[model samples]
Target: MKKHTIVALVQDRPGVLSRVIGLIRRRGFNIESLAVGHSETPGVSRMTIVIEWEDVEQVVKQLYRLIEVLKVSDVTDDPVVEREMTLIKIHAPGPKRPEIVALSEVFDAKIIDVGANTMVIEMTGSPAKVQNFIDVIRPYGIKEMMRTGRIAMVRGVRGHNAEEFVENANGHAERVPVMN
Candidate 1:
């Protein structure tokens, strides 16, 4: 199955997230990563969803069936900027602290906190870079790690703007304006 990244714009009301997730679950598409948050528009939310599926066109259509889903776009093939943030707590003995610090510096990761025996590093970058950092630091012993799933946006002027989609008189979504 090919990996696909799709973005959705939905209303930011209670149960909307649950409804969207439920719809995806019912469609039998396994989500690899999901990141959802408020968008530039006040009452709208944007979701970046990564899924492994044979055909993503069907998935996009299924998502649009949800009333809360205003717009959906498959951006996997688009020129986009993708990012993920991770916090890693690694074993950092006094003797190995400097080496760890230097390695973090090389990866452009930040040492956000330092305990006597451990250090918390914050890394934000493309998914591959984040994985490379984790692989390099694994020998030092990772105590705990948390990663914010992939979030992406199309590059340049073409991007998703929630306000561009509006509900028409028939209660179906229609593009009312173009947002550059």
Candidate 2:
């Protein structure tokens, strides 16, 4: 019932993403947000997945069974820096441009482009901040808006690193996060 954010480091190859998605679908887990991109290491990809599931540990274990998946971590409980980017196009005429620009400044949003009657605002922040900005700009007649999937990185020294996934003497896999 609660949302869990799982980050997985997997081999970068064709069909690997589809395979992961298929596995999640077969298990009946609904993905709330999915963001995948290149990882720190070449030929490896990082996937940030948000799903509403209780058995997070089970899911992580299942993911490890997949050959492409190199590491998995449930970052829901970890202290993390989560961010999302949103671009909002608002109907801002000459008279309303100043007011809208001021409002965007208050939220640390940037006015990327301005046309005759519309302006595009770009912002990056937490989900709550993004929602608040949207709420405030709703009255201004939004022309269009788009948002990127959530991306996160754990705080402090302990994080989702390649070194975390270590092979034991017997050749079994184990994760040992370096604790501060």
Candidate 3:
């Protein structure tokens, strides 16, 4: 089995997420991670999903068959930009405060809040980069953690454009403007 990342653009309607998840579960696919949020367009939500699949092509076709799914693309093979967000709270002694701050700076993370004995750090980056930051800060004692799953978009000149996306689905080949 190979790992694949798919970005699904769907109508932001109630029960849509549950229906999509149900399909995946019925197919016996393992979802590694899933993140859903609003897109630049109102009433549209983008779902970023990572899963292990035996055949990516079949999965993509199956997803497209769903009525509510507006667009489905397997971005794992594409040259795309990907990122994740993580928040970590750590117990910091007075003397260790400066050290922790420096580490966060090195990782380009922000110190969101500082208490008398703890500091909350927010970091956004690729998964490996975030894991490296977490590994380095674990020695200082992590008190809590929260993470937003991975989100991605295709990169460069060949990225999907809104009109092109619609036309492609409609058996037309005209270029269309990209929608965020």
Clashing pairs in 3: none
- lDDT by residue (42-122, candidate 3, tens digit) is 556789999998787877788788877777889998999889999999999899999999999999999999999999999
Report model 1's TM-score to 2 decimal places.
Answer: 0.90
Residue 156 lDDT in candidate 3? 84
Provide the overall lDDT of each model, using Cα atoms, as 2-decimal numbers: 0.88, 0.86, 0.84
Instruction: Please rank every candidate by lDDT, starting with the best.
Output: 1, 2, 3
Worst 10 residues of 3 by lDDT: 165-174
lDDT of 1 by residue, 102-152 (tens): 999999999999998999999999999999999999999999999999999
lDDT of 2 by residue, 9-53 (tens): 987778989988888898788898888997766566789998999
On lDDT, the leading prediction is 1
In order, what is each prediction's RMSD in angstroms?
A: 3.6, 4.8, 5.0
lDDT of 1 at 91: 100
- Which one wins on TM-score? 1
